[model samples]
Target: MLHVRAVCPAEHTAEVVELLREHPGAAHLVLHRGAAVSPEGDLVEADVAREAADEIVDGLCGLGLDRTGGITLEALDTAVSDAADAAEEAAPGEAADAVVWQELLGRTGEESRVNATFLGFLAIACLLAAVGVLTDSPVTVVGAMVVGPEFGPLAAIAVGLVLHRGDLVRRAGLALLVGFPVAMAVTLAGVLAGSAAGIFDPGTIDGNHDVDFVYQVGPASFVVALLAGAAGMLAMTSAKSAALVGVFISVTTVPAAGYVVVAAVAGRWDRAGFSLLQLVVNLAGIVLAAAIVLIVRWRRQRSAPLLRPLSRG
Candidate 1:
């Protein structure tokens, strides 16, 4: 369930109430008339079932409430009300299956921005992976993957493509286009420094170990990337984020990019080429899988509002 807080203009308060009254999924509805000071208006609140949130938000937007005032949704850690249980039961679909598009777009918009923090995390993750590649340490590579922030924008790109939002697609593209190259450059410098200090042995990397997986662009890589992408999409949409760490470790994106850097710095052109191939394959698989997941999740539901019509006296 989601707790929705809305500030509706005076003119739209009645419409807002009528709309909520029509939705069985809206429970514990509260209205405070003329209570808001900033952009002064009425304050309306409700606990809405996840299955019905998309429709309720759509109705509110259709009434122009978003422009006039604003609405915000917060997930409940626990809702112990009988009313909440009843609302969920009355909603047409299972809560777990629902996809709140507005919420997702809003989330991806914030994450897709190309900023210093985003780049910093990417650079650090890549540098860590460079160390992992040169030393042939699977543990270090997994750590880099966990620290990498690339998946957020990657998921944003998929969301943009699914929703046909050009701006989001461009934003996500910019982040990726700039971030990966910058991370690779930093990793290259790090590898050079490590080599000069005798911390990284190129011979270790040249041999077969867990690090070899970072450059092996085979059928297994593609299959794992697809599975990771779908799992990532599910983690992003659901309330629980524990699945995200598993998603992170399951893909070879950061490690592959890191291998490209280390191999290029070591003047191993063949290894660099294969590492780049691995990077491309993983990214392509992830994006395609995420886009497919979003399409199927959003397009499946077709039904009337979960709220039954009010009786005509």
Candidate 2:
């Protein structure tokens, strides 16, 4: 379930209250008229089923409340009300299968932002992957994959494309476009520093190591990326985010970028090119698969009659 708190304009307060009161998936409605000073409106709160979150939020957005007012949703760990249980039971779809478009937009919006934290995580993850490749350590490589924060923007780009939100697409694109180069540059610096310190030789990247999969670009790579992308979108939309770890480890996006840097630094143009291609291939596969799945799911949700919540006149 979700707890919704909204500040609505004076003229829209009654309508908002009626919307919640009539919605089968909403209960425990509270309206505090003229309670807000900053926004200068009424404060309305309600408990709503997770399955109906997408619909409820969409309606609010359609009413222009998101722009003229404010709407926030918080997950309820435990709602010990019979009304809450009834709301969930009355909603059409299962909560586990709900898409919650607003949730996706909000989450990916933040994740896709190009910030120091995002770049730092990517750089550190790629550097770890560089070390993993140099040592031919599969465990280290997997750890790097898990540490990489690139998946958020990737999923954001997919959702943006599916929803035709140019802002989201641009933000996600900026994050990826800038993030990779930044991470690679950091990896290059790390490589140079380690070399100057005599920590490891650049030639460690030359031979056929156990981590060949990082630069081996093949059909299997694309297949795995495709599957991972679908699973990733499924997890995001349905809120089964525990599956994200598997999605991270299954794709080689970060490792390939790290290998590209190590190969280039070692004067191995052939290997560098292969690794670059691998990175592109995996990225393309994941985004393409995720976009396709999101489109289909959105269409299904749009076509379902249950998406229309019962609102009072």
Candidate 3:
């Protein structure tokens, strides 16, 4: 379920109220006439089912409430009302399986930002992966996978492609293009510094370590990436947060980038080239699979009878 709050212009308040009040997937409708001071309009609130979120939000946007006024939708962790249950039951699909488009947009919009935090996490993940590769620690490599934040932007890019949002695609693409190189550069500097500091000798690495999988590209790499991408996209769209951890650890993007840096520092161009190819393959597979998933879901949702053109009257 979701909690919807909207500030609607005075003239549109009645129609908006009517729209929500008549919807089968909406419950506990509350209207406070002339309540908004900043936007200067009536405030309306309601509890809506997950399956109907896209429809309802689209209706609101069609009426220009998102631009002229304001609309806010928030997920409800626990709705203890029978009306809420009825709303969910009245909706077409199961709540757990619902793909809330607005939710995806909002989540990806924030995630695709190339901010310091995003860069910092990517750098930290790559650095950890470098250490994991040097020490041949599978556990540390997996930890780096979990710490990597690349999935968000990758998913964002897929979402943008499916939704035809060029801005989103551009922003996410920029994040990846800038993020990977910067993270690799940071890892490279760290690896070189560690070698010079006598902490770890790059010349000692023989490329026969268990962590060699990080740079070993094969059909299995693409296959695993595809599976991980599909699962990750499903987890994001269906709000299955617990499934995301599994998805994250299943891909080798960060570890491959880490190995590329370490291999380059060790003067092993062959290993570095292979690791770079692994990274590209993983990225391409994940994005391709994730985009396909979104396209399928978006098409299915668009065909649902519950979504119809909004009427101002």
Over all chains combined, what TM-score does candidate 1 have?
0.93
lDDT winner between candidates 1 and 2? 2
Query: lDDT at 49 for candidate 3?
Result: 97
lDDT digits (tens) for residues 1-313 of candidate 2: 9999988899998888888899999999998989999889999999999998878887776677887888899988899999999999999979988888777878888899999999999999999999998888889999999999999999989988877777888989999999999999999999989989999688977664799889899999999999999999999988888999999999999999999998988899999999999999999999999999998888878753322221211
Question: Backbone collision count in every prediction?
Answer: 1, 0, 0
> What ranges in model 2 sit over 4 Å off?
304-313
| TM-score, predicted candidate 2 vs. hidden true structure | 0.95
- After superposition, the stretches of candidate 1 with alpha carbons farther than 4 Å from their true spots are 302-313
Model 1 over residues 1-313: C-alpha lDDT tens digits?
Answer: 9988889899999999989887999999999998988879999999999988889987887777777788888888799999999999998878877887778888888888899999999999999898888777899999999999988888999998887777888998899999999999888888888788987766567684778888878999999999999999988876557999999999999898998888887788898999999988999999999998987876674352322211111
Tell me the deviation in Å of residue 285 in model 3: 0.5
Q: lDDT tens digits, residues 258-286, model 3? A: 99898888899999999999999999999
Clashing pairs in 2: none
Assess the local accuracy of residue 214 in candidate 1 as a C-alpha lDDT between 0 and 100.
88
Clashes of 3: 0
Q: What does the lDDT read for residue 143 in candidate 1?
A: 99
Clash pairs, candidate 1, are 24-307
* CA lDDT, every model vs. true structure: 0.86, 0.89, 0.89
Worst 10 residues of 3 by lDDT: 304-313
